[model samples]
Target chain A: MNKTIFLLMIFLSISAFMLVGCEFGKYPLILDSSVTSGAIRVDLNLPLPVQVTQTTSVNISELRNVTGESVDSMKFYNLTLLIDNNTSPNDAGITGTISVNDNALVTLTNVNISEFQTERSIFDKDLAGKGFQYHAGGVLFLLNALKTQSPDILNVTVVAGTNASSLHFDLKVKLYGQIFANTN
Target chain B: MTRKRSILFTIMSVVCLLTVLTLQVRAQNPLEDAIKQLTSENAKGYLQPFVTAFGANMNSGLYHSADISQLGFTLRLDLIAMGTVIGDAEKKYKATNPYDGSEVETATIFGEQGAIVEPIPGVQYQFQNGQVKTSFIPFFLPQLTIGDVFGTQAIIRYVPIPEVNNVPKVTLFGIGARHCVSQYIPAVPVDLSASIFYQSLEVGNLFEAKTFSLGAQVSKSFAILTVYGGLQYESMSMDVNYTYTGNIPGITVPDANVSLNLDGKNQFRGTAGVDISLALLHIFADINIGSATVISGGVGFGF
Candidate 1:
């Protein structure tokens, strides 16, 4: 009986160590979108509810090489969206949704662009006189979609409010998680 | 008996001399010596491996529940795996040339120079402050311990030069002594022992660390099972040295040599574990709590 109990404890301890190590070994990786000085102008005069979707692909092959695991096999944790708007007139707002390989993963609603512009200008003196906005939001639900599907391309769709016309904006995304790497 | 005593003394003396020699060489410019060989951006990642290795090495042999005399002689091999959460520690430093003191337009942010507009260049750029944040995943460390040589034990943990790996080399050696105080008391049901250990770990040319720990433990035997708990106080000192060779254009880079001495002193560690020994076969597992939570287990044989 004593031997059996000891064996059981050893098994439990090994299991706990494996689980905890896996949890803590994860590192944060930032997948940022290509930013250019040129603005992405969207004309909202065509329809009442105008949606402009910009698609960007992230190559996880390098990440796979570093981690020694396929991108699909890795676990992703926090997903954040970065929205940069460099335009004039504070009457517009944007609703952003992120999709992986056509499947919608995260949707952020009612992001006030004018308020974002005012808040950002507090730190950035360059944007103080110029009407520019910066907004960020956390998208935790993206993890489930990423696990269920193998996504190679990320699609960012920005829906402009009715007052949005000739608005210029940029979008970026970041994820934090761990991958299985070959330590040998 | 005299031969055994002489062998032990010789081993102890050599280890002490090596420790003293290492301290003497690194006492003045420890951090500078550690990082002096690091020149490229990629070499900066080598620092994380040493930190991870040290943490794993320190987490070994927490139980010490076995009385070597009762077991005749014992040898144990422990596989310790651990991960440490590295806080925001500055991993890089950069400075400009003071010879010309010529203010040049740069795209990166530098200290004190917030933002400037260059009328001639027709662009605005900030000085770059070269700082990198480094963190690593969990790794495994294998350790060996042999006990029952006149109430003393010898410990050695070594990882040979790895191929295509982040860490190049790791060597650790230590000695421990345990005294059973319960031998004098006939009515005592538990075996009590006090132990002191000293170890030194050297990771390639990056850094060297020496640790000294003192602990006391008590365990009660119940047939094939033994449960033990102990409190330990450990003091560790490390020397780090690095040099940077990469230079920014138009900025005269000075001789980049850095030396640092880090001390983790008077760390109180607590450990609790169970040992299951059936005849010559024994399996042990323990959890050590200190700056980091470490879980370790092993299987070994004794006569």
Candidate 2:
């Protein structure tokens, strides 16, 4: 009987502690990203054949939480556009633009392999001297517009200026922002 | 055991059983809840408040009575649980698409929209946005006290690096002293004492907390049962710095760190409880009333 009472007392004591210190909350800095990729094809026989364009759209609806709300504002600290022209023997120059709900937000012009190599070398120098080719920029205004517009859609179009049969490229964007919801 | 002792034991046993059953029923996805709260933008302002509440709860129920026998020893363990009552905040935001210079109106706290990564040509990876939500957490500590020098008892509590699943390495240490005032008045029927304690907790590099408390307590012993009451003044401070890295559907979180400092001053508290001792085994439970309600209980060996 003494042993049983001791054990019971121990159990109750632990339970009492667990019951009272039961609530807490945390606020953490968050970083999120979005990526898209596609190919652009050009035909010399076609009118305005100097340029070939490919467009794709991203749905931001899923970004909404239980409150049916999306971010009110955001800033894009890093934007990268990479083009691969190795598929074709001829070199192709590429330019790209990002739009939210059909409204243009960011435009990258004269994005080519040589320029990418040059920028990479400037940012990072190594004994190999080999560098990556990609277009990079910071667009806070564009992200703010996305938040203000609350557009459920984001569209991206990549235009390639080349005589090559096809040009393939990739686009990656990183955004940072706080989320606000209306409880009232 | 006497009739009163048996009845009190039965009541405590029933309460413990009910509490255990409630815990089983209340158990939910704590990880999901934690993530939701962390991702919410409005939760930023409430971080310090949450820490303050946590500190207050930690300071409560440290001691049941000021009575400490000269040359006596005791060992005890305590557990504390707390929850936040603050509501979530709401705000407006402006979004603009730079491509077309168009604007949109959206309502939600700020957080990462996540990223899509494709390593293979046909395979795609996407992550979801970060969200913050409120949750319940518990703290546990063990303490020891020894008395007899200069009418005072020296107290110590420690948890040498414990290995618990999902919890970081935790190290807790505390030092305190309890002085018996009744020692000077041997004819008094009531036991009187004054005590002060300081405790510090280090959970890896993610969290650190310190609390200092001073109180006076008195209890009258009747056979194996003792009823006690006390007034306490407590101060607490804490710091939290944690970073999260993971992959979720539709969103990729590369770096997410939550950091904050919390401090509280001169919180006065009142407490009352019952202590039941059978031979060397002791059981005590108490409730503290202050800025928050803190209920605590413990089992110990006293001689």
Q: What digit string (tens of lDDT, one per residue) describes model 2 on residues B1-303?
A: 466765775566446634543442232223223333432232233234444555665675566556776765554433333232322221123332222223333322222233333322322222233233333333444566666577787778775554334344556778988888988889988898888999887755655889999988889878888899888888887775555432122222345675556575328888899888877667777777776556666666556
Per-candidate RMSD, Å: 17.5, 12.4
Q: What C-alpha lDDT values do all the predictions have? A: 0.45, 0.49
Model 2's TM-score against the true structure: 0.51
Q: Distance from true position, residue B30, model 1, in Å?
A: 22
**Location of the lowest summed lDDT over 10 successive residues in candidate 2 chain A:** A118-127
- Per-candidate TM equals 0.43, 0.51
The DockQ figures for the candidates are 0.01, 0.13
lDDT score of residue A24 within candidate 1: 16
Name the weakest run of 10 consecutive residues (lDDT summed) in model 1 chain B.
B106-115
> Model 1 over residues B62-174: C-alpha lDDT tens digits?
44483535334657655444444333332222322211234442211101221232221212222222121224223344556676665555555554432223333456666
Error of 1 at A75 (Å): 30
Q: Which residue ranges in model 2 land beyond 4 Å of their true spot? A: A9-184, B1-44, B71-137, B162-166, B184-189, B243-259, B264-266
Docking class of 1: incorrect
